[model samples]
Target: MTDYVSTTPGLFPLPDWAKEDLSDLKGHQKGDLIGGDEDGEIAAAYEEARGEVIDRQREAGIDRIAEGQLRWDDMLAHPLAVHDAVETRGIVRYYDNNNFYREPVVSGDLDFSGDVASELEAASDRVEEGLQAVLPGPYSLADLATDEHYGDEAEFLAAIADFLAGEAEAFPDHETLFLLEPSLVESPPEDGEDERASEAIDEVASATDSEVVVQPYWGALEEKVYAHLLDADVDAVGFDFVSDREDNVYNLQEYGAPGSISLGLADGQNTLVEEPETIRERVEWIDDQLPVSAFETVYLTTNTETFYLPYAKFEAKLEALGEAAELAEVKAA
Candidate 1:
């Protein structure tokens, strides 16, 4: 029988203690002229900062931990460590205009010159054990990319998907699972846009061997989107149960294919903690319709990224979550 596993939404902000070093590195990576310290010093600080967050996660009893993304210059830059041609500096947003992301598209080819293996390895070592390395999905990348980048959007999407597939497969054995976050899934297109976007997503899902997860938060998934996912050959699908309505759960039960689901029970983006019994009750309700065995695992997580909250909030939220889990255990007893 497959064992149940748990995880959380990716990304954590740098703590105030580590802010200066993190900002220095960010400025250096972005080619900004910030006078503070040497790159080597900042690098050492980053390793320490990353370790601190990982330790906090372990203390919280989180099964899988991320390096709190302290090592990343930016969210997109995180993947740059693995793929080189895709320069973090290459991704420039057109912030002055409303169509900011519509800036000219850079090359979509795979660049593996700066493999993230070393960074991931270092992160693994710092955590005192192994943990899943997170990356954004190709579909989200393509959608988030500027239209100026390509003559053909479909072609670009396909190529990006292939590139991600290669990166996902190259990680060391310590990371048995890789998370491809497609946060853009929350913003469904008007009409024709949806079909084009779905095809791009299909390509990425087909490329990886690891358990591919499609996660959308802050909104409910549409029927067509759910149908598309049900047919995809992926390992699991994650939904924001904390934000999704009763109808959303009903739709999932009726249309979602029999597979593992990572349940987003806690609010990672906030300081408010949830009662584990409340979460258990929700899981039990879902279990009544779908056999427990149908799921490979039902992970509890925050609806969105936890880093958006402050460190104190994050700790408080974790404390609440720990209480909830304990309550669930007592009730189970």
Candidate 2:
């Protein structure tokens, strides 16, 4: 009875009205220097935008609703970017995509300042249940940053893991946390890093009771990396079925998967929307390959963030996912 479908974990594309309103208000665009809204005018606009994202997810029947990351500067660097000890430097291409993010330069000791907790708390006020949080995982955060303090890769990674753990501890109660760790796929770790990566992930997972899903996108991890990922204490691992699905399926068949898995059935980057029945068929195909008892719950989601797509396509994909989840659930029954 794997019957869960969730909003993709990251920034949802800003609506047209939001863009115009934000521009008129001189609001900071994501990846910009996140500014303070002293007069509460800019904050009001962001709140309204966040509310719309939540309402759309609810209408789409998403099981776990995200705050929509309306205030996020970017996924990987945001937490560190806001830290008092860190400085935002030149922009770098994010993974293999055209998108870019400010390189967070670590100048002093990294500390948690309830950066994401405020967003989660505000969203909690809007939705009575199923609210979720999104953050970059330690591995990716450390990998992407420019470390002027630690001076060592492993030490830097460990510090980041601990820093994020501190932030996770302060989060208000929520249903799920999507820890985006695309580095595992973009640049596989060197030998022995896998063990450290698992330990790092466990440190964060131990902080909160909410179910954590370590979602890697753009591609799948290699066998060794995937094996080590399974050793983590996280609740589930998300795979990008939209990109390099064969390798991901091979990893699952060879090493097996956790009882809970998030499958990316919808194409997040493409404009050609998938039909609900098409997505339902993809779920059925996955079930055929893996035993029924292989999973207690399977979460259907996008292979990547919907931020890349137009708002109309993004909403359509979400609606399709919700409908497909129902269809898949009925088939299992």
Candidate 3:
């Protein structure tokens, strides 16, 4: 029997109060508000927002909850943007979405800055259930930024993998860690690069006792890229069924599912709320496509970040996901 759990990809929509608090810091760069007098104010807002998000997730019966990533104004690139070693360059479009993030320029040796770890620690104290921490995968982070210090791409990736590994080592209390890798689907690694990327990912995953899930969204990964990831040391790999359901399902049929799989059932970018039964049916369909015992546990989640949705719609999506998980569990029993 496969246990079904519900979680989001993090970067949830900010609540009204947090938004208002950020309004004054408009012209300031991403993460600039985290110092001096503004620091305490902003931190308070984040705490309130995090509590609200966790409370909502609990109310919806979600098994794993994130810190809402309220400080990630620059999205996944935030961890790097906030680091003193990395310089923020011009704005870049985030994947294919209308959203944009400050491009992180590697100016010096990558190092653990303790920003994310501190936030995770504060959030950990607020939540009762297992808290999940989110980060950009090494390959994806390397792809997103330009390197000025590291002469070679592989060197830069390895440095990033090490930095991320150090961050993971700092947070031994987190139950799950999600490494988002949209670049894998958008720009598949070149021939020999796949092995290097996988090794870097393994390095980060090995540093954590928490269950690490590498979730690549936007679209289905190429056959070769998908195959390489299965060999990585991560606990589970998430596929975006919302963007390209047929192709993703076909990939599973061809390559076989991983030991643990996260099936993205909710469309995070859209405003329309999917019915709970509809999501359950989709999960059931995917389960039918996989061989029995192929996956030990299946996670139900949004295809991408819920920050793209309005607060109300994001809440609705969470409710739908929770309901679908319950439905799947009852049917499996």
Candidate 4:
């Protein structure tokens, strides 16, 4: 029988201390943490250091451990690395204005430069276990880039979709591509806005054979978008539970039915440890509605990104999430 898998929410803000800890690892003793023209020794060391973090997460029983995006300066930088066509400037501090866990920003065009592909392959090779490469969703990236690059957001979004699809196509061997769309649940778009964005995302979804999971966070998902997502080629949809728990549960029932779901039950952005019982209860409710078999795969996740948290806080959150999963297995038994 296929066992039920418990995975934590993706994206944890990584503090300098965590970066330091990663640096101490053998393969990453000399690598750069935030990119730039750092020495090759620093780059290799830094990549290996991130692999250490992934190992820790797997040891904690996480089904899938993101590289913690430790290599990135910010979420936007991740896309910037792959798509070099756009000139990325730091404007409109993402965290300062938006209350996000970290600072991210607007960019120019979709540049699929293939900068990250090699690093991803290298990192994947370093890790003793399987790892996922997280990238911001094209729609969310387009929204962030709206005012900065193009006046026509729809056209820009379409370009981003094409860019992301190319990035996905570049990596054929990764187990899954965790495409994060924390902004997808933001303000409901105007009349046809939702449809336009959905079409763009569909292209990305269709471009790859690897599993594509659409993960939206920080806000409640609009019913229309949720409805449209159900019809996409996505393998699974992810939701944030620490913040918009109730609405997400409803969305899961109404729209996530019959689809694989990665439940975001941990707070990746905050330091507070989530209560295990709370997580178990939420899983039980979903389990009751969708047969455990239909539930297929219920992965645990943090609310947003965790790269901003201090090491103590990040470790606490990870530990707490692991506890919650342990409690879930006990209850399921």
By lDDT, the best candidate is 3
Per-residue C-alpha lDDT of model 2 across residues 1-333, encoded as one tens digit per residue: 455555576678877788777776775554354533324777887888889988998999888898887766555677887788888878788788877777889999987778788888889998888888888888988889989999998899999999999998998889889888889889888789987987898898888899899999889898899999899988889989888778988888898877789888898889899998998888777777775336877888888887778888988988998888887787777
lDDT of each: 0.57, 0.82, 0.84, 0.64
Worst 10 residues of 2 by lDDT: 30-39
How far off is residue 31 in model 3, in Å? Answer: 12
Q: Write the per-residue lDDT of candidate 3 for residues 247-305, one digit (tens) a residue.
A: 88878888875578888889989999999899889987776777423588788999999
Candidate achieving higher TM-score, 1 or 4: 4
Pairs with backbone N, CA or C atoms under 3 Å apart (clashes), candidate 1: 84-111, 105-149, 276-324
Q: Per TM-score, what order, best first?
A: 2, 3, 4, 1
Residue 218 of model 3: what lDDT?
Answer: 91
Top candidate, metric TM-score = 2
Q: Can you tell me which runs of candidate 2 are displaced by over 4 Å?
A: 27-39
For candidate 4, give the lDDT of residue 235: 77
lDDT of 1 by residue, 1-333 (tens): 334444565677666677765565565332232222237877787678778777777777666676565544434334532343442334354222211121224454554432445556677776655476666666566555543344576667666666666665565544334354444445555455556555655565555445556666666767776675556566666777777756457767788653677767777765666665676676666666664446655555676667557777776555555555444445444
What range of 10 consecutive residues in model 1 has the weakest lDDT sum?
94-103
Worst 10-residue lDDT window, candidate 4: 95-104
Quote the positional error of residue 121 for candidate 2 in Å: 0.3
- TM-score each candidate: 0.78, 0.95, 0.95, 0.82
